[model samples]
Target: MRQERAIRTRQTILEAAAELFDEFGYEGASTTDIITRCGLTRGALYHHFPSKESIAVALVDAQSEALKAPERDLGLQSLIDLTFEYARRLQADPILRAGVRLTVEQTSFRSPGSRPYRAAEDAVYRQLQLAAQKGELLPGLDIEETTEFIVGAFTGVQLVSHVYSKRRDLLERVSAMWRLVLPGLAVPGLLLRLRVTPP
Candidate 1:
């Protein structure tokens, strides 16, 4: 179908762009590079993305795709699972890698730099809210504050893992992060049930 083909073409362009962005950062990767990498005509790249910034924005937005965790009970455990999923994807997904790269190097693009962080924090907040209702969270813990801290911590951990190990140790780093963070966030009993390692 035409729609299917269009969707595939758009994904192809995005993936090719993601590779370039991952390799050279946002400002370093150009439209010509994406065209050459994808072996697509200039018109095709232009048709999908009007400019390099647009492609950067698209890749940055795609960062959320890495946040897709399997459905589970909303609790501290689910939050851990969500983070582990993100770490695992960061190790393996090129699109996510590029999105993260663009997000971290936001000054290179003309898009809103905070958008991706806001989206990620929102997801964390949702899980924390549900965990609160389930009595899995620690008493008197502020969900918003905890969400912000957790997202920030994960960001830092992943950045370090990427820098030192090309993210090869990202899963282990995230597991360690949860071990340090869960005690403050989860109720003592709930902590016993939580699994920090990636599934």
Candidate 2:
């Protein structure tokens, strides 16, 4: 019970910090803001996170949660589902929002050797590798290069959506992104069968 309470306290502090980071960006958010937001004492906040940068790093690491999609046959569709799931989470999850925001604002937070982008790239790379094994991807397509491009493209799409409409149109934008990229990535028959939109 004590362990559970400790876990909950850590989550509470993380979430309160996320909310502040989302609203104010990394450099703008302070430990005081998080403590006040969560109604936790300075000691409690510092006990969980030594500094605001540690809180930001925790949020950045938490982005792995956003990559999770329901387990399904690993293929191009699974990869597509992953992106849609991420977009959906971005629309709803404050922690993910703050993480993405901090990832782009790396100059401000500066978590050394923190490879937030690599996590997404590795997720996409794994799916692409599976797609290759299953013959879902186009022949001669380089999985490594494709993984980088797909992750990079989705990053741009979501960032633009966040900037323009606060991600209100993120799902639509993701569908459009798949539509344009799928033709080039998947084989002809598989491309036609793939659902561009979220289920």
Candidate 3:
């Protein structure tokens, strides 16, 4: 019973921190602010997370997991579908939007030794490598570079959409990214052939 209560308290703290961090950003947010918003004491917050950086790491891990969930099938279409769904969810959820903004826009808060981001990067690289091995991606494409390019492009698009564009047109921005990126990364001649098909 005591263990269960502790688990619940930890989850509550994480949830509250995620919300506040999303609203105020990492540098703009503090431990006291998180505890105040959670209605928990500093001791409780410290019990779960030792520092603000730890909470940020936890949030990054959670968000990475959320983004990766739909790609479990490991097919080419699955990859594309997962990316699309992840983008859609990020655009729809304010908390996720905030997290994405922090990740792409606020470079100062990004920790170089962040375990969560490294793990997420490795997982994504493995996925891309597997896809390339299966001939889903273009032959001779550099897996690591390709993965970095895709992630970087997608992140840039999300940042632009979140910061500059109206919210209602987020989907259009996502589609435009797919139109531009998919052609270049996909197997040679495939996109051109697809474009040539009779409507």
Query: Candidate 3, residues 5-79: lDDT per residue as tens digits?
Result: 999888777777777776777778788888888899899899888988787766666666555634443344445
TM-score to true structure, per model: 0.95, 0.95, 0.75
Ranked by TM-score, the better of candidates 2 and 3 is 2
Task: Please state every model's RMSD to the true fold in angstroms.
Answer: 1.2, 1.4, 4.5
Which clashing pairs does model 2 show? none
lDDT of 1 by residue, 1-199 (tens): 9989889989989999998889888878889899999889999888888998898888888887776556777567778899888888788888999988878874658765688999999889888898899888888999989989999999999999988999999899999999998889888877777788887
Instruction: Give a tens-digit lDDT track for model 2, residues 1-199.
Output: 9889889999999999999899998878788888899999999888888888888889989999878655667488888998998898889989999988888875666853548788888889888888899888888998888888988899899989988999999999999999999888888878768888987
In order of TM-score, best first, we have 1, 2, 3
Report lDDT (Cα) of residue 198, candidate 3.
11
**Candidate 1 Cα outliers beyond 4 Å, as residue runs:** none
lDDT of all predictions: 0.86, 0.87, 0.65
**For model 2, the run of ten residues with the poorest summed lDDT:** 105-114
